[model samples]
Target: MMPRPPAPAARPRRMVSAFTGLDVCETAGLRLAPGAARVLFEQDRWVFAALIDAHRMVLDRELIWEFAEILNPCWRTVAKEILLALLAPQHEAVLECAHAIRSVRSPRTCFRFLQQFTDWFNWLTDQGVTRLDDVTQHMCERYLEERHWSVPVPGEPRRRLEPDTMAEVVRAMQLPVLYGELLSRDGCTEGFAPWEGKSASAVVGLKKGGPNRVPAVPDLVLQPLLATCLYLVNVVGPHVADLLDVVRAEADSGQDLPRVTKERVPAVREVLARLRAAGEPLPALSTDVVGRRVGRYGADPLTHLAWGRLARMAGASVFNEYAREQVLPEVQELAAEVGIERPWARQAALIAQADSGEQVPWTDPVGDEDLQLMANYVVTACLVLTSALSGMRTSELLELSVGCRQSRSVPGGGIRYGLAGRLIKGKRFGGVPDEWVVIEQVDRAVALAERLVRRPQGAPLFGSVGLSDRVKNLRGWLERTGNREHWGLPVIPQGPTSPRMLRRTLALSIAERPGGLLAAKIALKHISVATAEGYAARPGGSQRLFHAEMHAAEEEHHMKLTLQAFRDAQAGIMPAGPGARGLIDALRHVDAQLNEAARTDPKVLTDDRHLESLLRKLAKALHVGPANFCWFRDPSKALCLRLAGTPDATRPLVGLCDSARCPQATHHRSQRPVWIGTITTIDALLDSPRVAKGEKTRLVPERDRALRVVAEIDAAASTAPAGKD
Candidate 1:
């Protein structure tokens, strides 16, 4: 082996001021605009956009790294140099700092870490630590301890940081150590290798699999919430559309356009004539507004007429000073005759009928504010329906546009519905075009949403509002007494809900059915069942339901049969099969328990809960089949296992099960339908001309067996006294 050369000596400790002339962006090899000047370590801020492509996340105001927030100029310069090294190419970083950049992928990642880093430095500053090199291990450990239950923001209450958040804080501390050589001497922490070389995740003890902390919306809240939203979109939507059309037609008729008094007077008189004929009152202020004007401003209640509404209806800008003097007296006389109650001239009467048979008007009076509020409610309903049914993320739903609905016919004459939208999750540069297969309800909701919020073709259907806030507003609207009582909507249970929760809820609901694992995987667009399983097993998700549903179904089927048999025994019906003796004994045991319980309470036999517990053990032994119930207490006598030459098997193979002759199987009234169907099938086969002698012989025996089972069931039913059990 060759001898090695001596290692180079470390650079001497120095102040960040010594590196003032360094062009940090150029050193990091960041992309730059044409002829842009270099960003130096001396500056208090770094405008990263001047050096690279526009960031997708940061707003225009956040384009720059404002090191001024650090307060100390020396610490600011050191912070910039350390972050610049993190931005360097992997090879460059390895050459300079002797460590490869791992955590940060883009400037946004570094930007997220910056705030926590600032908090830690601010805390250090408060401790009277003047420089990074003076940051001792004791101080770093103490900061971690304090942050475990500290106020995250200035005015917020104290909270223990979640595992994910604590991990981020630990990563912030480890970054300085990773780039210690790249930082000035005073910038590096004097620690004994932060956390003793443990990774941030290990130190914080984050779970191995990504544990989705977002919970599914509980069924109690989701059921009525979706029901009310569906009512708005499917039932109330057309009325809103018609009213909006009327509103738009009046607005677009050029009625509100500027016009001379002489040209508009006849139009105003014509509107009055129509209102008089229809017996509609002129628009007026509400009682509260009338009182406010009379008491506060001392104006006559008669002068509170909505003259602006009249002017717009008559193709004039407003009821001007001259026109009001001319029209005021005539309007006052008409108001006194007909009375002014509603704000709108034409109302949608009886929009919905309550369950108690009360006719509900769309609204008492559709004022401008009221109309807008109804329209907003319609939009909120559409949003809720679309999110719950389609499981689309907020970003994807916001990317939906007008006329995005598409449909195609399936082979079975069914139409498959889909909505065209952009997938905003993985694709960064203009999102990838995708289509979501949805139910008919979501399609109707999208249509209603388009009508509520008018947008041109290909324009975004919804605005970029926070989904959480929108859902909160929707629940608030539903809680209003006027809206609830008038609309006849059910009470929406209170709980936190969001787009992510809706998505996870959809995943969980689908995963709790038979053959639902595959359905959930497809519906959620997951690449594998394992991924869907993880979603179903999330914290506060449907883990219990997903695991227990299949077993519960089998157990429920057994319990039903066991309970029915006991009822038959009470009615003088008896079992008659190879396994009849065992089934009769089990029924006798259930009867004995009921008799004992009835000693204390005469109604114990009628109690379903008490009966269930008594019969539960016997129910577990009953394995239901198509034509028989296998009392599978002992696997040694299982006909299916014996025929398959595996008598030690824990479960019987249904295909090989000869329930008719099995000693552990019994037939009852419930099996009568299967026996009748079998006989019908055998008779059909025997009557066919294609039957050979051997096939006819086989069919005859099968038909006879089915007839005998049917005879036994009929005899047992005939012997039971009518109106007994």
Candidate 2:
């Protein structure tokens, strides 16, 4: 056995000088940044002690930086007085406060602890609390409830302080309970934990998912987004790569040069005008060039970058320069080429497509707007596709390096791509490297983005100027691609686009399907905070949590849906199936489990498991079709299938139904319209001279079935009494 080497001795502590370093500009053994000392001068002895301890013992740069940053804002304002007042009285209380927050070393943690603790101090003073011993469980509960802090947020004008932040504030407020463990016992009373389960913030509900709240991508938005990503990855991507090569060759031969000029003014101004009309704020140009501020709306980076560059070139030696060498012509042609043109009205003519804002791809001339627009849309598409599919958080999404794609063979067979990146949040120095197992669409999105940047290893995959810019670009893309008539609300709605939303949406979908939470764990990196301990990255535990969260969310959603179903039944607006009443009966039976409050809560019903199972069961019996529908999943369970002596595959075979006599074919108000419309279509076919006798024979029974459904609904609607529950 080898002998262990002697452990090195600890370094000597840095001693604070008189008047908190007022005499000397520096302290021996103190490796604190000078800025830290300047801020320390404004704080009291306890704060200085804490800061010095952080510098000498903790030696955490992030902690020191946070202290400096948090204190600096107060040094020049009324915040300074507020800070001084905290340290002026109850020296023992202040020291106890300092010691209590000592373990909180992260800059964000430190800043939050100090700031919130100071706020707590003021609250204590306001409530006539002169010392730590004065605090009670009631006081802590009162503080949590009456904190009354509100912050301004984008889209929302007045957002209240988050429950998580309030939770932290409450934790800091309760530190006095630690007594001897937290601070010296000389000023501490007979110690007791004042806050138990009574703190209001302690029981904060999981709602909005904190500051990272983002709504899932709506199915209306998702369909087009997926379509656009597919087009960009499969079609425009290859074309653009080839075009880039051509432009590169021209530049290499000295036949192409990047140019900016004033003649571009008309095109640039036109694009800018449209952008301004869309209510987006323009980016600033260099050298005192002012952008016309549009009314209240979000910011878009691609449009801003293009416009900022053009604005900078306004009077620069160009546009008005024909004396210059003819350059970048190939690049200009490439930009002029249309990679993708948008959305046609589904049932409208090709000309109406232009009327609906889609430009002609063949004969339509591509302008500067088209060039910039295409580039912006391409970037936006790649970002949306990659972020949504990969389940990477915003920082990870931003930090995504080019050439991040890795392909590996799956156990079964074939290959899958994993998008690799480093997780920066919650990490101190060296970030934890992680990857997401992605579908082929995500792989293509990354590849397309790589082609755009030539896959630079050092640069961000989807570079936006700022968080606002990232959000703006997302909002802009949604607006540009959306169908106005279909999507009634503004495409971006009123909130921010964040990575959490993408991760949540994917987790929710996976959990609801057969895959469940384990599937989510594999898909989402950093999904679980429980793994955040041990400094060993969980890779994607959040996905597991996300799965659990989605189940809760889904259960909540089903509760609402079930309530609506009860309303329909009570109002005599029954659904179009014999199973509808049975489903309602099952819900009532499930509701018997809840106490008096929940039994009649109008929203909540059976336990999550019971409720969710009921909903799925109902869905299986509630099959839908285009023209005629059937409410059955299995032949043995279905009356219509039993009479036919045929087993149902996955759904009811609507053509096999004898609707007039089929016990499973119950009609309601909504289905009556479909039945009526089907009857009209069949009548038109019957009236047609080109109809063959055999075809007419086939149509007769179907016509009779439609007639029967209409008669059935009419009979039900008329005979059924209308009332409220």
Candidate 3:
């Protein structure tokens, strides 16, 4: 006690002052923060160059946008931890951690690790964590259950991290051990293996199927959109082409149409008002689409621009839609053909009632606007057809160039169509040129789009009409199609028509149908089979949707069979076979699980888990076999199969079995009808008068065998265990 503890060795004053002055939390050369001090020279420089160079977009844009002000809080806190850890004698371990983070796939991922780790470390700080060595596995788990992201929706309720998000947090916390560099570095390894034997399930329960889960587009929307898309490509598009050819061939050269000037503006506005007042559906045209329509629809009078497309095309006068005095006769005829009932008719009637002395009841129908209106519909149709058949996302569809069609024949017979384009999503660069294999429908739509898109253009196949505007117009097309008396289909959708829904619909069909994940792999262009398997449980887990559904369908079928057996048991209609007791045991297990659920619900089984458990028990021995019901089709248990010397056949050779003697055959109440019918047939066969004594001798033994099976089944049922819940 007297030997005054050698004054605790002094810290280097200059280094302490430098560390105190610096913002150590900032990430400097991937040292957890961009501006963080205490940077490792060669190690940090390489990581900085790799991260900013490789994962720039994820870091500079997406990550920043995702976590704004809260990001600095994360940076500041983690910086403090790094300063403390590095100030210790052994600083190389922390440097190793920095180098390992640079090894992540992208700068985005590297930053994400930094962010999540900071979150964990900061929470640890509150829990009084002085160094990384002080961290514990229990503390890691508690952080998983209790951590929340910094970003919050203004007025929405906030909760702790979701199970999937928590799983990512666990991954981040465990990264130090996961990366080989962290382990090999020279340092004390006290807390290095805190999560060595643990799994994600040990920390949190998984969640499945919610708002984030992709759902198939409804059939009503899918059908009409498909039909209309084809119609536009195969039918209307050709008509528009034919007209353009005729116009160009006319050498009709430069005939001018009437243009509205300042003096004619009042009259033009009157016609527009009349059209609106008459209750017709107005087109939802974006400014760009409206501008295009003015030139193409000859409605340049409304645009007020003297040098509009329609005006430019005429080379002189303008064909103003409003100035066309009477309703165009051709438009009225087409309207009648489509059964629109001329919304102008009602307005004309109202005008007649007003009767201001010089006026007769008058109507002005759609006029030159008809052709352009149909053109808009055709554009949406083309988009729908291509989008649905191609399985391209919205961004990819928009990125499509005018010449995005490619087709070739492989060694196989079917012609393969590939849509040439760049894949934009998850691409570090401006995506690479990857051609997607497509169906014939998509090829046709692409051909039509090539013809329709304005020449002298860039990458976009569809013009500047935005996707939101297109989706809105798509719904309008359905409403107009469904309400039209000329159309027979009642095909209005009660849902939205976003590109996402169409892609999801195709995915659901591929996953749920007879086609498996391999089919989805081809359609979605996923490089790995594992990517398509993500469609099963959300966040991509072990069980795929196809396998889960297939198992479910099999179980549902078996349960129906089991319920029939249970009903037969209740009625005391014992089956006539040697395997009856096995089925009786199955019925007892079913009663036990179902009764437990029935106690609370009192109707159908409300507990899925209990039903699943019951099905598992029933599946072990219940194999539907020919002739007699076989409880165990297992090769080792089957007398016929064992005698024939086979190993694990999927089904038994029932015709080869000794039906009356095979121990695996379980006779049930449902089988009673078959036995009764069989015994009647046996009696008939035995009574045939034409039979010789020798033939009857052979028949007598077979008849005796059938009767013996019936006797054994009755005896077994009588001695069977009584079923109870």
Candidate 4:
């Protein structure tokens, strides 16, 4: 029967040779261990483990890629040559590459870049083009135009490639020409340039300053998710910590039992006496374990006893047959006197306030498994809280470790909090050390995460689990535990969620407030000066997302002011200033358009879209000032521009503007309060006996001017048709 198993297969041996072509790893700035093999083609796999950092998100398998794994022989030949050139594009074997890719630091990134072209290589094979020189511009253009590079997946629905994905595909096409010179003689495409040298973005039809598509977490979803997370961290976290403490104590108290002797009876009886002295119930199986026992043994009462708990309490890992047989009746009597409580937890159940204003238990009685689940949920909660408040990228958040919380007292009084971590984006090899200045809540969240998981000083707090999945699981757990309903938390709406989305949400929210654009820039740690300025100069800057949100806020701000002006004019409260006539005329024109539209559809006057469209032009001309609104319809007529001697300036110079004298500026009742306050301040100063002669002269004219403006505002409001004032 044992016809002798076939002789064991021998392990394949790798052939090593003297280094020949080039030290591609050294050229790419990868440090290899001394005395390591440098041969390239002889070995199918090249290990770069020494070059990769432990904290890097890359997998261990990716450190040593197997070039031999590429099934297509022709594709494999070209891929290997292309990878070498990309690693050292400045080498003598490569032609002039003005936009040469900087050295690829991550092997995984390089691997993906080469792998992106497998489908295209197959297309080339089908066209009977075996050599790189045969890949012409026409073939490249056809590949892009027909989307031949995208292969259909088995179960995914067929859809057109996303613009970002397509952009990457176009880059893949250009690589053949970008590194073609470095290829072996037969693999070189000496004269061909992909798509005739046009940029990848241009080829993909991506417009400059196009709308940003990064999804910000919706407020409805974020608000509830954050509320629940905060509750978990502050309210329920202590109880969870207590439960974990019990588990740890039990685990650390090893199960090595003392040798059994006559003293066992006295020890067991003494433990029972102590338990009875205290009002505590006997330790028993959790409800879940009881259910499991009932399921297995047909609901027999004897199957539900927690013998292991009693044995552990009696200075033994488990009870022997002698103690069980002799002491079963006493144990039954003790169980009847004081009911059994769950062995895993001794803390009181947490109370949660329901939406209907009723107090309820946060969860059902928890078993060991349930306690572990709660611990995991608490970790997810901490992650959500940190990400929502810190405005850090996913990679940066994942880079956080135990004891990363940093704090220092400020000069004045309050303490500033920060998290020390490494930045993965735009860094070479191991990420550069960086720190995020955060609020107190974020600092506490990081601390809680550390406490939940017992990691050493530098051990990573969060894993590489998909953040989207974590959020989904968090919401599911909250729902299943009735925490959402009982705690009065809003239902988190369904949507795409990631750390990037959370970061964008914080940026978008901050970008909408006063002086928040600069605050958002600082909060997001956009440290590059060029990146800050590129919003005005370059279309696709690093701050494009922030720029887009800020620009939208600006547009919304102008529209709100213009709409208020229109509503005031409709109520006959005319603006009173040098530019009052011009402002009145503009409002009348917009009102006329609204009335004209309302003739056919009575609801047109009330429809937001209709009103917004009619007022958008007037809104564009409005420039809000500290004490006045500048209707800058004509830059040539702006007094501030004339005084500054900048005829071509698009925006008004608010510092130089004299609103009372400038024909483009207007003052409404809303602005009159500032003038009134100024008048009162000057009056109070003029009335002071310590007033100097020079101060008196300055104060008299200021008070008179303010009084005149106030009178005008008063007259306008009193004469308004609504006349409520």
| lDDT, candidate 2, 1-725, per-residue tens | 99998543322221321123231113212233445534443343223333432311132343432223323232222222222223232333334333333221333344355666567666766676655555666776677777745655678765566776677766665444432332321122344454553453545553544433557765555544455455555555565554555444533554332334535545545544554455433332221111332223333322223332333333332233541223234223323342222111112222222124443232122223343344555666688777666566776676577888888775777765666776555553224666655666678788777876654585567865233355466556546544322223233444434567666666555433322232222332322221222123342543334445655655554355455554455566555445445454654664454335555667754455544554555444543333333445345666556767776555565556654554454455645666787889999999999999899999998988677667656655564474432
The lDDT of model 1 is 0.69
What's the TM-score of every candidate structure? 0.63, 0.51, 0.43, 0.67
Best candidate per TM-score, number? Answer: 4
Residue-level lDDT of model 4, residues 1-725, one tens digit each, is 65876543322221321123556576555666677666354455667766645344767776776666655575665576666666655554443444557565366677676556676777777778876656667887787766733467898766677666777778887776665434443343444567778888888876667644677787667766777788778777767877787787785784576533355767777777777778566776765677788887776545556777777777777777787766677766777777677666464575665345455555555666667778888889889878877666777877888989888886777776767787777666677777666677677778878878877998889876477888888888778767677667667777777887876666655543322322221243322222234344434322354456656756776788788888888888878888989988988887787777778665524457778888898888887676788898899999999999998999898778888889998888888878988988888888898998799998898788888888877787777765544
- lDDT at 355 for candidate 2? 21
Could you give candidate 3's per-residue lDDT for residues 697-723 as a string of tens digits? 887788777677667666646744566
**Clash-forming residue pairs, model 2:** 257-328, 261-319, 262-319, 525-540, 526-540, 527-541, 527-542, 527-543, 528-541, 528-542
User: What value of lDDT does candidate 4 attain over all alpha carbons?
Assistant: 0.69
The global C-alpha lDDT for each of the candidates, from Candidate 1 onward, is 0.69, 0.48, 0.50, 0.69
lDDT (Cα, 0-100) at 505 in candidate 4: 66
RMSD of 2: 14.6
RMSD to native, candidate 3: 15.0
Instruction: Rank candidates, TM-score, best first.
Output: 4, 1, 2, 3
